[model samples]
Structure formats: structure tokens, C-alpha cells
Target: MSARDVLEHLQRLGMSGYEAKAYVALVGAGRPVNGYEVAKRSGVPRSTVYETLGKLVARGAAYELRGSSDATEYLPLPPEALLDRMRREFDGSVAVLRSALPAVAAAPEGHLIHGLKDAEAMLDRAEDVIAGARRGLVMSVWPEEMRRLREAVVDAAERDVEVSVVSFGEDADPFGGGRPGAVYQHKYSAPEAVLEDLGYRLLVVVGDRREAVVGGFGEGAAWGIYTADPAVALMAAEYVRQDIALQILADRVGAGEIDRLFATDPGLLRLLGRARS
Candidate 1:
């Protein structure tokens, strides 16, 4: 990249505009230079050059050296040294935040259901739920939802969170085409009939069996509800449990028989047959 681009990137990493320019100028000089020289070469205003140079020295991005004439000269920190210092500081900050925030934050109360709108919002909540999972997660979702939440799910699994998923769609394995946890692919015989009847793909996620998110997407819209209520979470967990039970039953008794039962059941038929308002 060009020198200007490099300076812009350094500015993004918490350096002020004048600091970046002054640091760039010092590096280009390749030796200790007074503030006047930095201001002249970097085109920074003389009024702020000394203050900006002081900030750079304080921030470990530059060093203040006493010249032969007893004038204060500034030397830019080598690029490698500056980057290493920044990396260490950033890592330390994140570690402190990770421990401190959770300890000071208020405990979540149960029985609260927050309604969320749109697929993006639901997916964001899903990511948070998965990332916060301490014990386990149970979910019923389609390939599209699975793909969207794949990274968070994989991270949870890697952290030893037990993950169980009931994937309903054409593809059998949704964890990046490989199995990462317990996966049960629904095998309704008339998949089209089921899909057409619902008119949307349903998604349900329960984290640690304490928090749950239930939603659907399709038909040009998306919606979901997130609940920390113990009762609602229990129900949601059981909902996924039942799906798992059915998959096991289908495995033992044949998927076709289970599909035939669903097709012939009068209650299911009525519910599926109901017209959309």
C-alpha cells in the first residue's frame, strides 16, 4: 500500500490524524527530528505539532530524544515494535473486559419474552445465544438458518457446549457439510406438502435449556420471539426433544411409515389445511 494508506490505517488503530502524520514523517526522516521538522514535512499545523508529538511519545508510538543543542527530537517507534505493543495492550483490555463485565452485570430475570423482527435480528440473537451457551443447545432449523449460524454453533461446540440440531431441509448435514454434533435430518415423505403447508421455515433454539428463540422465515418476511422464561424455555426444549424422538422412531419403524401417519392424521391434516389469513 501507499504511504498515505499506511498512515490512514495507523490512524484507524487509535492514532490521531496529526499523530499519524507526524509519526509517518519521523519514520520517513529515518532519524531523530525536532517538532519543527516533523510539522514542516508532515504538513501538520505548528500549533499542535508539539502536543501531538508528546502524545505519540506517551503512547509508545515515538521516543523523545535530547539533541546536541538540547532540543527535544522525536523518533518514530519501529513499525514492528509499535504493532507488538498495540497487540499486547488490546489483548489485555479484552481479557479484563471478559472477566469484569460478566461479574458486574445484573443477572437475567426469567419470564421475559422479547419480540424480534426480521431475519437479521433473529440471526443476531441466535449468535448471542449460542455464544453465551455454557452447558448445551437444542435447535430445530433449516439449511438456510443452519448456514447463517454455523460459526457460532461451531464455536460453542469447540468450547464443549453440547449441541443437538434437528435440521429440516434437503441437505442432511448442515455443519459445513460435516457432523459436529448430534444431527437428525427430518425425512417427511411428502416434503413438498409439508413445505407448502407451512409456507415458511421454522427455527427454534434453546441455550442451556434456559433461554429460547423461536421464529420463522419466508413469504417475504421474518419474525421471532426470544424468551428467558423458564416455562417457555422448557417448552421449547421439549419441542426439539419431540422432534428428536420422532427421528429416532422413524429410524426404527421406517421414515415412510411415520410420514404416512402424518399424512393421514386428521388433526394434522386440518391444521395444515387451514387457510392463511
Candidate 2:
């Protein structure tokens, strides 16, 4: 990265701009640098250079040395060491907050629902649901989303979560080529036909029959809901279950017959937002 990018990243890691500049100057010098040299090389003000160096020393980002001439010099902590220290500190702080924040305010007990603003957030919520599944997981996903969430689903299956997936689109696979759990290829509706009817590709994920994420993805738009409501969760689960059942029935009765029935039946056509000729 560029020097400016490095400075910006350092500042993000809790260093002041002046401190980051001074530390970079010291590291670039390849030896201890006095305040005058730091200020000259870093473009930090001469008046503030010593204070910035002191702050860096306090933060373990640099070391202060007294030369034989009694002049103070600052040497940067090695970049690798500084990064390792920052990672440890950051992880420790997150661990503490994870335990402390829950005690500060207990979450309200109810059917909590959250709206996901876009596709990334929707997939992230889906991954969280999959990761949290202890008993069972039911999901109806398209090929694109399946690729993105395949690892998490496989991990859940490895944890004995009893995963079942109804995958849409031509290339959908729950675990690449190996099936770790029950994976059914959706055949009742063509993916294009479903998208034409609904205006988007749909995704449903239910975890342990307790939590769910139901969402839609389009070319440049996505929206979804994540809910802990048992009723919503059950509905999402049932959606996948019914899709799986239909796929199984198609396997027995033939997909062509099922397609013909849906194509001609007025009620089914109406359900698909279509009119039978």
C-alpha cells in the first residue's frame, strides 16, 4: 500500500495522525530519530513532534532512547510486532464487550424481526442462522447464494445440525458435489419463471425451527427479514419442507407431469401469478 494508506490504517488502529506520521518517519529512518528529524521527515509540527513521540512510546508503538548527548530519540516498534500487539488488544477488548454488553441491557423477549437492507447483509444473516443451528436447518436457496453460503452450511452439517436444502437454479449444490445432508434440486418451477413471477430470486433459511431469514435478490437490489419469531421460523421451515416434498414427488411421478399440471391448472397458475390459456 501507499505510505498515505499505511498512515490512514495506523490512525484507524488508534494512533493519532501525528503519532502515525512520527512512527512512520522513525521506521523509515531505519534508526532512532530525534524530534527535529521526525518533524522534518513526517511533516508533523516541530512543536507537537515530541508530544506525538511520547504518545507513541506510551502506546508501545515506539521506544524512547536517551543518547550520550542527552538528546531523546524515538525508534518505531517493528511493524510486525506492532500489528501482533494491536490484534491481541483488539481481540481482548471484543471478548470483554461480548460478555459485558449483554448484561447492560437484556434483549426484550418477543418475536424480534430485523430488516436487512441489501444482499450482503441478507447473506450474512443467513450465515449466522446456519452457524447457530444446533438441531436442524432448512433452506431454500438459489445457485448464487448457495455458493456463498455453502461453507457455513457444510460446517453446520458437520456439527450434526441435520441440514436440509432445496436448491433452485441449474447449478445448485448444497456441498459442491458431495452431499453432507439432504439436498433436493427444486424442479416444480423454473428459476426464470419464478423470478418473472416474483420479480426476484428468493431465499429462505430456518435454523433449529427457532430463527429464520427470508429474502429476495435482484440485479442490483436486495431486501430481507431476519426473525426469531417461532411462527415466522416455522413458516420458513415449512416452505423448504414443501419444496423438498414436491421435488420428491416429481422424482416419483415425473417432472414433466408436474409441470403439465401446474401449466394447465387455473388455481396453480393463479398462485404463480399467471393466467391459463
Q: How many clashes in each structure?
A: 1, 0
Q: Give the per-residue Cα lDDT of candidate 1 at 257.
A: 84
Residue-level lDDT tens digits of model 2 in 1-277: 9999999999899999999999899999999889999999999999888898889999999998999899998889999999999999999998999899999976787779999999999999999999989999999888989889988988998988898888886467767657744788776667777778788889999999999999999989999999999998998899889888988989899989987998889898787666845
My TM-score estimates for the predictions, one after another, are 0.65, 0.70
> Residue 219 of model 2: what lDDT?
83
With a 3 Å backbone cut-off (N, CA, C), the pairs that clash in candidate 2 are none
Put down candidate 1 lDDT per residue, 61-82, tens digits, no spaces. Answer: 9999998899999988998999
Off by over 4 Å in 2: 1-56, 65-87, 94-99, 107-109, 146-151, 170-174, 180-182, 260-277
- Model 2's TM-score against the true structure: 0.70
Model 2 scores what on Cα lDDT?
A: 0.89
Tell me how candidate 1 scores on lDDT. Answer: 0.84
